[model samples]
Target: QQQVKQSPQSLIVQKGGISIINCAYENTAFDYFPWYQQFPGKGPALLIAIRPDVSEKKEGRFTISFNKSAKQFSLHIMDSQPGDSATYFCAASMSSGYSTLTFGKGTMLLVSP
Candidate 1:
């Protein structure tokens, strides 16, 4: 079964705008949620992540907002740029000593100038 669900199969944003992506999970066992960014012909790279212990986490222009009770999370990109155009994925996994990620369907973001 798909553990995570992501919305807005595609998004378009202008330069300097903000882009948002959202995801939700039904499994309470998921303790780690991470968002990944992937460009063409490349593997997904970890962008931002959050543990249920924290409500939010931020790194530079990337931010992750987590809601444990609701089993939801979202990613925000500040100052969206053309270079930021890529496919984004939200993933969930248990920190059960093994590193395995179940990813949601990707969202393709286009940041145009």
Candidate 2:
């Protein structure tokens, strides 16, 4: 119930296209769902997030579509860009004190020019 599973360890999307990645978890106790985007040798930054209470969340060109009953969520990058190429991670964590996140193996996105 603590694992977040992601697919397509790597992906190549042309610039101006859309990049999609999927993830699922088993833990119903988890309250926060966040996606982090990381560049080489850099720490992951929170891109966008959605609580279980919400069905979806969007930030600029990034969007998160969540499915509560299916225990799944996905990240959609609209208008993929070379600069958007990075390692994306899906994570889950409980709201309680000191809850560390469980991250997916990671999906490397490559946006070609």
Candidate topping TM-score: 1
Any runs in candidate 2 off by more than 4 Å, and if so which? none
For model 2, the local distance difference test gives 0.94
Indicate the residue-level lDDT of 46 in model 1.
89
Query: What's the lDDT for residue 8 in model 2?
Result: 81
* lDDT scores of the candidates, listed in order: 0.94, 0.94
RMSD of 2: 1.2
Residue 43 in model 1: shift from native, Å?
0.8
- What TM-score does candidate 1 get on C-alpha atoms? 0.97
Task: Give lDDT tens digits, candidate 1, residues 3-112.
Answer: 89998899999999999999999889889999999999999998888899999999999999998888899999999999999999999999888878989999999999
lDDT of 2 by residue, 1-113 (tens): 43899988999999999999999999889889999999999999989988988888999999999999999999999999999999999999998899889999999999999
Backbone steric clashes in candidate 2, count = 0
